[model samples]
Target chain A: MSARFVPVPTPETGTYWEKAAEGELWLPRCDSCGRAVFYPRSFCPHCHGDDLTWFRASGRGVVESFIINHNPAPGYEQDAPYVIALIMLEEGVRLTTNLLGVEQTPDAVRIGLPVEVVFEQRDGIALPQFRVITGDGASG
Target chain B: MNRAAGSSPVIIAGAAESPQLGTVPGQSAMMLAVSSARLALRQTGLAWADVDGLASTLPVVDLASYVGIRPGWLDGTVVGGCSSMLHVRHAVAAIRSGAASVVVVAHGESGRSRVGMPPRAVDPASMAGQFEQPYGMSGTFSRFTLPVLAYLHTYGLSPDDLAEVPVAQSEWAAGNPRAYRDKPLDIHAVLSSRMIAWPFRVLECCPLTDGGGALVLMSARRAADLDLEHRPVTVLGSGESCEGPGASFMEDLTSFAGFREASARAFRESGLTQADIDHLMIYDAYAHVPLYGLEDLGFVGRGEAVPFLRSGATRPGGSLPMNTNGGGLLYTHTGMYGMFAIQEAVRQLRGDAFAAVPGVRTSFVQGIGGMFGAAGSLVLSNT
Candidate 1:
């Protein structure tokens, strides 16, 4: 049986998947409009420019908000309740990521809590998750 | 205190539910669309031949072929749940511009049966599939549940306010015979219900049901030419807009700007204000939706909806009566719940809804598609 579900990456988004597999977060930077694109787009969202550059991100952000799921997802029955969060990165963009190394509850998770990207490899595919850099259990 | 009450070019001649709601067996999604269209056409005293235009939330070519109406004009706008509401707006534009005379807007969703849209075998593939889905998250329950915490924390609200929404809507549902849920729901029932996600109980989510609804629209002049039994509900003004692609892109998680922009355009075009509306229908797929709608639509100030809701302003005999169809929470939510709101709006204007607000001259319906992805607002009136 497969350890996890890995999405078949499109030509446009395959770069993001490939970079994450190498333990690096590569975001698209628009040469024309200078806007940072997420989910690996083909064109610059700011100017619709096709000319874009890839750069490894600082991978630092804070929790804008989060929710703890008590229900089971399709591929993750053993991990019923987990924290899904919108992390506002230091580069002024937000992305959805899982908050790890903390209690998966509201009391444990607070808005503006600092987090850092930590990639976990499952079946040779790297999935990006967040861990607390500074919080109630910062040292933990 | 005078408002625009602007003249409208088009009016809804008739509308109908699929007549087969809840667990509709063996009926495919397209089948329900055809059935609902037929029901609505019957109400208008028109035949399939009179349908010169057809707008569908489903695949337009398939539904058109299935309904056997080769329309002069067809709109297949598939944004999300609010697609049907935009269809009404688009249909009006189509007719007023001499695109088509008689227009039929239909919605058919087999949310429970999963006829055409099969249940997830593999995980969904989208932006969310890449980011949120991998983290034991994905599905309507997980997507919508993310907003509650931000809303509550931003507004300094408690769990009790969230619990009160479904409970109050259930009271309205109890009065509606066609409402899907027969079991009584209360504050304790909602809060104590199984927590699907943090701060969202199972009762807070919309039930998966198989159903459809449709509307038959024509020029106001055409409505006056015929002796219609029901009051002709005019489409005075309509508004629609989309914000970011997803909630993650939204700057303010607490409020939806799309709802505000859409509702404002409708009101501004109609020359109306929040005070002028006698009734309202905000899509409540979950309890927090109404909270977002109320504040965003300018019915109440930001953070004022909780107190307003607690005051029962949205209940029966209130100043601003809303969601008399029991909403998606208790009433039939065939996935896209917008048309049900339109059905209730038309019924209220015709003076024949189960929980009708007294002297309802104007009804405003707000249709939400996706998680703040799109919105459609319509100002419907009998005047």
Candidate 2:
């Protein structure tokens, strides 16, 4: 199968992709506001502080919201009937990610479903995705 | 206070849609905007030379050159679909400051036909491209409707309640000749329609259409000097605010903070309360938006908007008539729909609307840009 769209990292977000390559989910936190930031930026969104520190996150979250996309983006025609979800991380930041390893239906995937990070490698880029957590060590 | 209410009054002398609407595949975006501006100017019995200020999503210089007017003041603030609402607010400031006498705010988008539209491109290094679009986020259907499930789960509401929005708005559309979907709709019809996104059926979303609309704003003093034909719709108050990067980054899943901020500022500047509003027009790119607008604008309490809409309070002959032009959902949505919303408010105030509500003394129009990313609010009155 062909590869999907890969994100090109910027100066502020280069470290995020590098850390994901090592199977670590890292995010920047503002020292001034004591808050975590997403889609890493040079300055803090909350307090406008330049003193942002990168920290390894817990890599766990709940499905805050989602939509089952029937239409697909470029390179995603085969990936239709997929779940595009908003995962609220334990750090209080939300990331738009794909929910995998679950039946693409309202009965299977739902709001508040606990999930953990799983990376998908795409052409030298590591994308952080999420899968439902199962106690039996089996997803979905 | 904002300039519209704090300083000398500015009024919309005339507002009009393009001569062709819904499907004008022949005209480009600039053509639609210029034609609408011509209709507006003609309605006020003024020529292109009378317009000295320009505001639009189009490049102001290009719009001015094509329309044969050299604008002294220009505002091209773009925040997605609500850009026209912000333009009206900014035009009030320009006129109040004496920067320009006659200001025209216009909008045109070849959403359906894509005539002369630029190819959609995204910077690989941008925040949305790096984060949101990497997922299966395709377009407005995926991104704009992202928060809807959370909104339903938070309020213990069902998709049926969300379906009620289009059902109610369709009642107003039934009387509108210009509405894209003027037939009466029911919740079953809405739920049974083709699913664009989960919990949002095709009927619940704004139809992709080709259209354009414009408004001519000048001070009451300028209108008098021009001896305009129509009754000037007073720009009582206006306000705007932007949230974070996009819908996923919104602070709250259920309530839109930008809507609350923008509407509060508009009310405060107008020195009016919700009780004084006789009409309402909340931009409905999606059915869930009116629910957010009704609640965030303080017209109803938290979690009360769905019930209020189901009660038929916003339908024609109801207590508060709303979306009288059938709104963006049933009316034409040229991608940027704020200009059409403002046009309906002006028409209702002028007593010339297709679904005109009797004795509408005050109308509050609210608009949302992008995926709940920003908001612009305007309070207008006939008296």
Candidate 3:
């Protein structure tokens, strides 16, 4: 089956997607205020600091919370019954991503479950995802 | 800001709402707004010509102009769901500054019945359309649902725990003659309802309504001198804050900073705390919105709202009478839930609500806009 998709990249967030392709989560850290920022911006919104740095993350976190998708959007019909979770990084940042490699039942994906980052190849690009870090040797 | 000598005190002189607003067919958006405006003017013993300031949400900009006097000051604030509360706050400022003597804030929409207004053609060169829309994060429901699910997971709360808010609010609605959903709902009924997106069943979501809500704010001097039998309610304090829009940029789904900031400012200005608020009219576009808002507003400790709700603190006649007018869950939600909060607060203060509570001298109303990205809080008092 052929899946049609497109990626729209902006100047501010282009580096983020590029780092994700290489199996890394890149966030802008304000040099002056030392805060990790998202929605990638050129300057720090908090302190208006121009000094910024891109750093790699450990890619390990727990599910802060999640919702199961029973009604998939039009283009995502095939991916019905998926789990969308807010994963809280150890560094105190949260991002939305799909939890793959498990049943999308509410009972199966409890809140605060341990999760580890993984990537999937979608339309020649690597998209970040997460899966439950089961102790039973099931690793994505 | 210094108040002008001749400025009005900005009291809620009148309020009116349309019946069964969202599901009606053949009713235009303009008609809904006009009917509510007329009802409010009649209730306040004022005429259309008496209104000098007109404010409305983006959905009904043109319609507001068509139904009222030519406003010397017009404010069309479209900050998503909290638009009405922000409008109320702005109206108070305008009145105190002597920019307008009388202001009317109104909203109405057939959001549930309408489908597919053609998408605006954004510049292909624009980064926003290219980056966000393609990821299926176009609508407010989809974006807000993501954080709600996360909040549920982290708290170890079941769907039933989240379901209790709507179930109890619907029960309150059952007693309200104007509530759209008058039937009582149990926890089981809420859990068994069709899932819109996993943990959020149909009952957890606010209905798409086509109703109109209007509130008339006049100067304290003018309200006191009016020959009308009903006394107006005073605007004690108001506060507003806006955060980044997208979910990715939010600090935490469970903790909305905007609400916290706005609520603190409102409470500080009003010289009241959670203990002082006898009534609460929280914005409830989704059941979870109020759950988070309660925590942000310092009514309960973080992650403790579920139990606070379970113990029935938010029910009618409880320690805190909350959403006594049925709220957005059972009352009509025309995209913006802010108007309903203002209406409920004014009614409670005036002792004119369908589900009026006794000894309600002070009331608090909170409105959430744009997936918890913005918040507007108000405190009203009979004293």
Against the true structure, whose TM-score is highest? 2
DockQ of each: 0.56, 0.77, 0.42
lDDT for each of the candidates?
Answer: 0.82, 0.87, 0.76
Against the true structure, whose DockQ is highest? 2
Runs with alpha carbons beyond 4 Å of true place in candidate 2: A1-3, A138-140, B1-7
Candidate 1: stretches off by over 4 Å: A1-3, A31-35, A47-51, A134-140, B1-8, B116-125
lDDT of 2 by residue, B1-383 (tens): 13232355899987989988888899999889988988888878888887888999887788888887788889989898889989999999888888888888988889889997877656567787798888977678888888888988888998667788888888878856678898999888988999877877889889988888899988887776676878889988999998866788889989999899999999998999999999999999999999999999999998898889888899977898989888899989988899999999998999999888999999999999988888999999989
**Which candidate do you rate higher for TM-score, 1 or 3?**
1
lDDT of 3: 0.76
Model 2, global lDDT: 0.87
* DockQ of structure 2: 0.77
Mind giving the per-residue lDDT tens digits that candidate 1 earns over B1-383? Answer: 02111233689988888888899878888888888888888877888998889998888988889877799899999887788889999988877777788899999999898887646533335665666556665567777667677788888898557877777777677856688975557788888888887777888888889989999999876666576768889888999998865667676788988899999999998898999999999998888898999999999999998899889888888888888778888898888889899999999999998877789999999999977789999999988
**Stretches of candidate 3 above 4 Å error?**
A1-7, A18-25, A55-60, A90-92, A112-126, A131-140, B1-8, B59-61, B115-141, B149-156, B175-177
Q: After superposition, how far is residue B110 of candidate 1 from its true place, in Å?
A: 1.3
Q: Comparing only chain A of model 2 with the true chain A, what is the TM-score?
A: 0.92
